[model samples]
Target chain A: MALADARALVPHLPAFPHDPAGDGAMLMRAVEACERYTPMVAPDGEDALVLDLTGCFEGQGWTRETIARDALAHLARMGLGGRAAHGPTPDAALALARFGMDELADLPVAALALGAEADLALRRAGLRTIGALAARPRAPLAARFGRELPVRLARLLGEEDRRITPHRPAGAIRAERRFAEPLASVAPLLDVIEGLAQRLESVLARRGEGGRRFDVALFRTDGHVARLAVACGRPLRDPPAIRRLFSERLESLSDPLDPGFGYDMARMAVPLAERLENEQRDLACGEGGEAQPDLAPLLDRLAVRFGPDRIRRFHPRDEHLPEYAARPVPPESGPAAWPRPEPGEPPLRPLFLYDPPRPVGVVAEVPDGPPRRFVWRGKHHRVVRHEGPERIAYPWWKHPEGRGPTRDYYRVEDEMGQRFWLFRHGLYASESDHPQWYLHGLFA
Target chain B: MTDSPILRLGSRALSAPVPKGRGVIGLDVPEVDRWLKGGLRRDGLHEFYAPSGSPPGPAMALALLAGMRNCGQGRSLMWLRARGGRRKDGPHAPGLAELGIDPAALLLLELADPADLLVAGVESLRHGGAGAVVLELRGRCRALDLTASRRLALAAERSGTMALIVRGDARPVPSAAHTRWQVSAAPSRALPANAPGHPVFDLQLLRQRGGAEGLHVQLEWNREQAVFRTPIYGDPPAVPAGRAEDRRARRAA
Candidate 1:
């Protein structure tokens, strides 16, 4: 009449039971639900999750026993059958929850399975229940099960104690708040979010670290929940900066918590973290003050308001042709510096660059310096002073079709003092195709 | 008869009002001072037109630094868009320091974007407290003109600073400046007996107010001492009379 004998008589159960959607899938969903409490939730096996609730329990105002019971109840509510136990080691907890729940009064060595040899020794001693098994002399158990069995038994009974060290993901931080009363409305929720962000900022500042990706979760009444997530281009710890990124994400949520009954708690967690060095500006010539503005928040705002593709930065390609110089890239992903043309080259370049060089008509013949007259966009311009024939050849090695021609660029000033940077796309030297002309840029 | 003494006292007080001075040194003369004023205005825009194809020299740059250092203390002098010269190619730090300008007080902006340069200039002018702004443009000054110059001038005035635009030969006329200067290499000095002579400049005072047109002045720049002084001739040198009139006729043609 022992717990192990009872389990053995019932017959061996599969690691997971078959459901229409699969038990593994359901367990995965349940594990994801645990993220509402902490982002440090990890799957222990096919059917269980190991949650590092050390820091989380204090905020929940719950003891370890209460947390364990509540987690069992939560799983039950989700229609998942599972048992829970609070113990020092993961192995001990699993064993207790699986085979030592009944016969709480009897300290049974036989009930606990310490492999085949320990099972045989316990059978010979006629001991059952954790209480009875622990009360017996440890010397005999050590001689039978080796040193590991006794130490593990003490840990299981909460006597000799062990610690379950939780695995923390890299670049992670956390902030949380528990409300005395369920809170409703966006204003108060924002206030709580801001407070949490400030706490995270101070923590990160002390550690010289910052968070690149953050998750904000609201644990609502009746176990219903809402969450907001944001990803930044760079790691940032400034409170205002964090708020700016989150505010946009907050505005994008559909079916936003109407505080339909209010959220009982809120928390922010950093899943992917980074260390940031303090940045100091130069006092000389105010150049330090002129650094490029942080475009992350703006891009986030745009992505929230007008989809992810709305915000972009120009990235130039490695080509000599003016039209092929640049392309648009998502603002969130780009190098620190924009590319520049090689030095010591004189081709009249435009200040306000166009994406593709616009083609124009010319009346000039082959071997021409530049057109004396060209009509662009249905308007005629007479060139007065002209300079160039600065040749630019396409990279033939990369392009099999070969970029058509060697461009002859010109710096032409018109009668109205408007300077144009025009180029003939193909030269007379290349016989593969028809030569073309294009108006590349305008000089201010 | 009783009112005579009171009337005389009021008249004397009105007539004895305090007289303000003409202008600051390197800031008052025509041709030279006019450009200097724009270049040295508590906050103003000065434009320099260097010959096309010829890069700027140390002497020209040092002359600019001398004017900039007179603004005030703790003022930052920023060089926006450095062209033609590398850090080692030019006498950058020590040259400015030799002109009584603090090299540490300078900010070198190696931006390739013309728009970025303009934006920096505008920001510095708006904020003030900065000592001076020097921008070197490879092409012409068509992008920066009278209206932009005026806006910059107003900003400098509000901030109490200055803006110097150094451009190539193809630059258009700047309308907002008090004066514009075209700087070119002057003839080198002839060696004198028994003494190592310093180099002298054949400065042509081009474009000044009150029609102060002349190319007669010869300035000897003492590099060691960082001073510009008129060189003393041993005796009264022979004058080339009417050379100015001859030069005017040649320009008209």
Candidate 2:
């Protein structure tokens, strides 16, 4: 019924505007809460969550009914009202729960999720209930109504099965702990994390594998999930080192972890793992000059405290443009193999390079020749000896509009012996009337 | 011979030899090494400052070369600096490669502030895996005080990694450094085409812990041989214009 008619009949009914985005956010939170039961939880529509409880039943040693009942109670504690059901496929269960009915046969044809016109056409054809549609021959029903109708009908009847893509990929190795009472202190949190790490270590050692990345999910009592993730330089399985990394990560957080209303459970999972072989350690210090201490632990500690991006290794790229020739890569990619320079060539590149190249006032002997004198940063320099203009043409094929102007670069040394790399932006006569000069880099 | 009776000391004590901690990595320039008492100390803290209103490239390059000498082979070279020191385009990798520094063993850390940079520097120095650690600081850093320098010195001594601090336009302060030097760029020899040759550095030893200080030397870097040579002087300046005109005439013919 329209709100106007309802308001006229029963006066003073509070009305608010419809908000689809707000409703979707609330549904996503419900999906996150349902993940405590199984990692394979997906939000069905704007109202319901679908969880594939396949092995969870056997793992927890609980019947399907008890699990569904416990899920509903858990949602209720989080101030959400919902209905739960069990079926062979996720689609059947979602339809049963959304309609708030136990029997699938009594569900209306709207559960097929066809457009409004198709729904009206199906009802007008005297098929108002799914039971009537399922009883008829699927060939004629698809021929008359639509091809999608039979597929939907089959799913509702639990005749076809398709898995739901979960919100998070289920980890191969994981451990979880639940507190009897709400744990409010930070001391016991580390202990709980340590216990979980120990459990995960034994499983990883048995398989001769170690984890490269570990994720910790802390479920607070007030329906909030706080997550922490850390990656190591090398594959690691020792529990104490893992605990220390977590402690360092916690100590460096800007907004410290707050156990609002305490935490209900903590779950630790290894998302990425690699193979690690056990090796015998040397009895004495390593022989010769190769006895270097392990640097991975120190790098890992600093990376956790200060972000990994801050610690980097140089990676060179093969490009003609100076700016795109090199980049700083994060340390986890390991050291990059840089191409060696020619043995006899003098240092052609500069140690420090400026971006957008600092513009300078230049006075050259000829317009198309090398620079004679230039002023930069309020200091004037006379170029005694200079090299030819090494022409580096910009990649014209990369652009769609037209070809970019050619650049004339020169390696000029000032009277002070400080060398500079300068380039003319464009050809003087062909590209523009007046070309600009820029200081690109400085050589030691 | 005819000495006072009260002055009874051994001749070995009279020599007064300076204690060289760990060892020294020579630069191979006979003149500078003689003043350095065998090149720079391997397990010591050394500071480098740029000249007045000049760029820090010369100072930075000098530190890296000395650090590489201490590193030798198979060990890593780490550069630690505070944020805002680099432009959009970072340090050129090819230039370092031309200088014979292996890119695979180079590690860089740009911290949030000066304090964090020092902390990370100390941490890196504590590890023996680091063959050389270069700490680059710009401007006047109040965080790097005497105590922090002392801490870095102690850690470097314990781990046997050479530490080089490059201060750009920053005044020299009292610290536990074993030697301090001021580095500036000097002219290079003209190559065949009258272009600039290799890099040349003019270094002034401002202070040494237990040795003579006011020594000045000019050294030119030879990339092929991976060594420094005293620049050869006493020749007229080459006229680059004449060389260029001659090449043009030959091409036209």
Candidate 3:
């Protein structure tokens, strides 16, 4: 019915426009808020949510009924009216919420959320309640009303199994701290983190494992949650090291943390872990003999401060293209053997090279003579000596574009005592009449 | 004086001092090594600067680094550049490898802030694993003041790691650097005519603490021998008049 007609029938009737988008955004916010109770919270359609509280409240001194009541109360405080039910399966809990179980066999058929046509058909057939529907022959009922009715009925009556997918991954090991008064400063929060780290260290140590990823969830009193996550370079169980990593991370964030009202609770969790074993320390000659540089801690501190992408190790690639000759990879992941120059040889190449070689005006003898003098960056230099015509052909197979031609490189020294690596783009006779020259590199 | 043996021994000890090997790195060249108070000091900051628009400062710094890397076999080196000063086309590994530097032994860090360059330099020196730390900053940086240089020098002294700072096109300022060199590119030798020869540098020692300054040397890097050699004919090479005569005689024959 239209709102105008409904309002005309009842003089004082309240109505509002349907807003599905706004409702969906509010539903997501509610799901995030419900994570405090359990990480395994899923949005069940638009009006309901499913939480697997199987092991969530273990040792928390709360039973299923109390937890459900608290959850409803929490939602009520947020200006939302909610009803909850506990059952062995999600379908049973959903059915129980809309129907009373005092007379278990007599619940109305409308609670099944089936189509209106199906409800009316069942009513016309004298199947008024669940018990009445159960008394009828299964095949005729299913054939008339479709097969979904019996399946949903079976799931609701605990005859079929059901499952829910959590919105976020559940933590394998978690430790939470609740405060009587909210924490407003960084020091106390860091103290709490240190305590939690120590606790997690012991737990990980018992299983001969260490945490690879640690996440801290901060719950503010104003209903805002801030999450901080730090990843370890290796499986780490040291509390001090973990604390230092967090300190560096917190200090390096561009957007500083602001405790608007204060954080009421904070929880730390290990989402990923790996096996680790302690190494035997060398007691004899321990002072100076052991010179192994422990680079992991330093790398971890740097990676936490400046993102992992910013800190990388270079690897020599087996390619002739100047740019493709080297690649940057994550530290500790590159190949062990890196290419090196022959011992005690003067450097054959320039110390610095400009990628996509910069253009420079060249004055050379006719044909293929080296540049007598070159003008680079608006500066004229008289070349006292020059070397080269080191011809490097383009790898035509790799680059099908074939736009690039063979280049002849020369190392030229100017009067100012500077050496430059210059190249001609193409041969004068074979490639082009006007072969352009470029400054490719500098020899220090 | 000859009456007491104790007095005579005291006088002999006072006259002859012990040959100390502190703060000196040998260049293996007799003339330049003797001129540098033994060699480049390992305990203090050495500044390499070139005029504005010139690119020889980095070259000189790299040459020195190549020399040091060869001397300290197991030690690593850290190279830092200001993030803003770095071009997408700055230094490539293949090029550095050609300069006789092991890419694995060099840790290159492009810091975000110019101030962080100095900090990283000091830290790298203090880390002790690196044989030397090279910091390249373009133009002038306000954060790299006297105090920062002093801190770097102190760190270098304590850790015995050589500290080299390369500056571009900036006037010399008051710094804690123990030695300052003004390097510029010089004309190379004409061995094979029209072909570039080994790198030639006109390095001027502008300032040296507790030592004479205003010393200039023409040094040539011998790629085959891996050492710096003083040019035999100094410079200009007598205009190479004899080479032209030889070419004319061969044509006549």
Per-model TM-score versus the true fold: 0.46, 0.81, 0.83
lDDT of 3 by residue, B1-253 (tens): 1122121122333344333455576555554555565677776788888767898534444435543543354555666775553455556666676655566666567777777667667766776666777888777789999999999999988877788888876777889998888777665555534444556666777888887676666666665465677655434332233334543333234
Clashing pairs in 2: none
- lDDT for A42 (candidate 1): 68
Pairwise TM-score winner, candidates 1 and 2: 2
Per-residue C-alpha lDDT of model 1 across residues B68-93, encoded as one tens digit per residue: 55445445565666333332122233
Order candidates by TM-score, high to low.
Answer: 3, 2, 1
Model 3 chain B is weakest, by summed lDDT over 10 consecutive residues, at: B1-10
Among all windows of ten consecutive residues in candidate 1 chain A, which has the lowest summed lDDT?
Answer: A339-348
Candidate 3 or 2, higher DockQ? 2
Worst 10-residue lDDT window for candidate 2 chain A reads A282-291
Per-candidate DockQ vs. reference:
0.02, 0.43, 0.30
- Ranking of candidates on DockQ, top first: 2, 3, 1
